[model samples]
Target: MSINKFIKASIQEEDQEPSAPSPQAESFSDFDRAYHSMLCAGCSCLCDDISYYMKEGHVTRTLNLCEVGWKRLCAVSAEDRVPPPSPSLLSDTVNQAARLLQAHPPVLVLGADNADEAAIRTSFELAGTFRGISLPWAYPGIRRFYERAKRFGWATGLLDEVRDRAESVIFWRADPLVTHHRHLSRYSLFARGRLTERGNLDRNLAAVASHETVIEPLCQQFFQLSTDQDSALIEALAHPGGGGGLDHRDLPALARALQGSSYVALFVDPEKVTYEALDAMFRWSAKLNTEGRKRMVILPLWDAGPNIEGFCRVSLEKNATPWGGPFAKASAGTQPEDTSWEDLAGTVGSVILISSGVDASPGNVLPKGLSEKPRVVIDPFKRTPALKDQVVIPTALPGLESDGIFFRADGLPFDVHGIEVWRNHGYPTVRDVLADLMSEGR
Candidate 1:
């Protein structure tokens, strides 16, 4: 896609910044009733029903957000604010970045999952322009799923379809209550849809993991398998009669449920299961469709970040390849070794990270050796520079300070508008900054 085409068609120039209140409407009473509805870009579960109160061009309060979503919105008013740099300094940083791009070969444009659609597209463009590598910091299992999807296709449906038609829902090491608090209430078991008029009453829920979770009480059956035992459990499910350690009594019942359900939705947490295990589960689910002609599908529960799915979609559209690995080569060769984030950082001469509001709690971390290298981090919250020699460009946080498009967990794109403005910081979105860099680089 042309840069100008995207900017002109998708983004409105005025929407890049906060709109000052009209003189006639700038009353104290207006502040009290200045409620705005916007999308939350916290997790992959980008809830579009967020309500916030804008006071004097700033977001003062928010409602209808869970703890995870609330924290993301609250980043706008973080106490440790990094003051915006001067114009010359900004120019210098961008120039340095451009020079770095020009000098460095195979520069890794990392962190696409954390970015919005515009930024993701820009990253791929930059990668193509400079012949750099673009990879998402996603789980191995997620990456494998993408490859498998390309190789042998997948049976999937939208979250709304799950609500309306799924008679049975199985969660394998996926705890929606923690990872996505509103998932259960809004789209799954408890949600009342067209076919599932009675909500939880009409749906049969099952959980598979090493231990029980908050949803265990609602599950009709819980298949307990210790860590690294997913293979064993899957084998048990495949052949009910050849029961391994899994209780013989439960295997038959679980097998019966899998076969009986006309419409089943299987949710898997990539963080919890290995790539092989997940692949096995998906193949088995596919077999159900092939043999029994059952309506069974696999739904990934982990949201890599906002627009991670968008990155994958765009990558496929542009190059007919999946995301999360090295960028495509001119001539196809042996597959590259799967490099860890730490390993990639050490090998690459430079890295460009566009982590605006990305929260990495459990696994992602930058090694000190990698942090010691030259890098560019475009963030709005003035997060401390991770690298020793890095240009930290304070950019606007999408879904809050600026308007942009992001993809949901189910691989659907939606436009997110800027609701409140920050008068203190002249934060620009990743799109604008990248566009500027592109212009300057050329």
Candidate 2:
């Protein structure tokens, strides 16, 4: 079915569900009332202006949610949802998981990218307790970029800042329309901001990608180049008059556009380019700023789940590193290192998979040996063809069925309240489950 049809059907289905008075509902004359400022856990954008019209406990209608957010809400009642395990069974499973971690010297806690701030912190604590390692299921390129930023300072600003003051914006192999559905309307291109009072008209927009994208037509400049040409193109832009040995006709014009603007924001998806290309992009932006030519910043653009930033932040605070460690304890002061899928498969002794709504599944990308390791899966939905000898614990969907703190793509924190009561579903939050394991260990 088409996306629109599917969304329409999902909305219709939600509207048809019977409603009952919820204990949490506020006193209202009307049966249906709208709750505003609800955060959407669809992607890293975390659009916080969502409004849900609730009839008693059920969400009868919604406002400000994009197709991706609508699908996320639909998933709360998806037919394939895993039935909640009984409390006794849950206790037993937690005990078993604790025992497994205790036996495995270095437990690999994966999938923090999709978890809430509290759960992510708890995951690190759990890892520290068991002399384990915690890492987000993010692209290697992103990890590399973060590492590079520590060595050579990164020039970045918040998305709100980009929306307010940016005179020129370039989408460098990043397509927000597809990944972050509301990004253009809410934070970039079309949003009316302080200095950009005329919105798109007042700002210059450019896009660079390997293939055609939906955003290309909206951009004033679009560079469609081969995957290998990104480094050369960036080099050309970094040194405008030098040509940098590239023959792109638009290179001069693009450089001129950037140089002419007072404030420039370069949004890039690290996954779309190699480490060298990403580094060059950052350096180019830095050079532009240092030379006093323009106020330039390179903002990373990737769907690294909802709270990858939260995980990195927590890791930095607790481990003195953003994304690597089998530290014996929290705040061990270990230098951060990037962990690849191959390294994980070969090094980690055991696994604790925190499968939140995002696609945290290793799928076919991970080595077979990683799957063979003793594993514990905490997820809201049931896995097809369940793994052998692995414990699967059902959990509440973050930002939808549970209340917690989540960070946006720009490192801004949002206190997300659950739109639906989680207890009604008999599932615990990821934090609760991890806390249980920690208690079991004690």
Candidate 3:
């Protein structure tokens, strides 16, 4: 079937009214079956309650998947999927990639944000083997927040806990309506939990953003400020007695919401605010917990990628730093610090990118000179037009075409099981390609 038809069928299934019967109501033909408890890697939520029906190797119906998740599943039949290369061509390409690394002397591995845990580890191992550095794409503020949380302490809990017990929710610089479509309905604002029986009605909702967001209407209090005012607003909220010389209209209402609620969950998107503001917010949350008068937790909102959390976890385990680095022994014990593409662009000779579900071209997302360097890209989709010097290896899409362990944004791990339909593609996984490259180098 064509990609358009596949997408249309999936959307029609998703648009079925809430009153419709279960998908199981349909007859099960020999080629038709249902799979449940599948995880969606479209975002960091890693929503695991997804169920779908496959007819003759195509997804005909689905349940509990948002648009993001639906598109991800439809990506299996996406037209941009890289065509499988012949065995001899693949071997030659792997050899070429190995030669590039050997000649470059210090490869910069990128794009682990969308890979599985095993693939992330292998990327690190590949970097170590080549005397290179493995850097995954992530928000700078998130790395800063991790460092601060380590030193000052992080008063955070699982999303499930927030759903069950949180009495107040403050979306500070977080726009879940756009970034994480199911986050509010499944975990935070609208979810009906044991204690939050009435969902949004039972909790006080507030939002603090530089501009208007879709979530503002649902919030009892909305604080709209300019980008420059974030630090001052956080400062004022941190120490209400001081006032911080910030004349904000919604300050009093925001303060009242926090003061009245016993349990507060403050969700902040680090990308939208400066590090100073994030640090101040963290300190303020820590202070609230220290006072023992109320329970306040800071939950960061950002989509570095679905498994960026896995990258951080693996980096911490292997390199002793959340940011992937320490290529030399001298920096082995160095403290964790934020590393951006700009930091590594001039230092490395070549790059090895392992990405999945990324639609942007390298020239658009990568640093200036880095895109011009010799590179090897392992991805399920064709990212860029062919270049004689560059090597592009096709791979199976993790969580849809391959099974692996992926971490949600909350740092919880879930096993992603692939359906059997796409196994015939005969494409290697990121882990497989990395393993081949490592072997070829030896």
Top-lDDT candidate index: 3
Estimate the lDDT of model 2.
0.75
Error of 1 at 152 (Å): 3.6
lDDT of 3 by residue, 177-231 (tens): 6777778777787788888898877788888877788677667778888777877
- Over 395-440, each residue of candidate 1 has an lDDT whose tens digit, in order, gives 7777777777888778788888766454335766677677766676
Higher-ranked by TM-score: 2 or 3: 3
- The lDDT for every candidate, in the order shown, is 0.68, 0.75, 0.76
lDDT of 2 by residue, 95-167 (tens): 9888887777577788877778999999888877766778776636556778768766788999999899888
Clash-forming residue pairs, model 1: none
RMSD of each: 9.5, 5.8, 5.5
Give Cα distance to truth, residue 33, candidate 2, Å: 3.4
Best-to-worst lDDT order: 3, 2, 1
Indicate whether candidate 1 or candidate 2 has the larger TM-score: 2
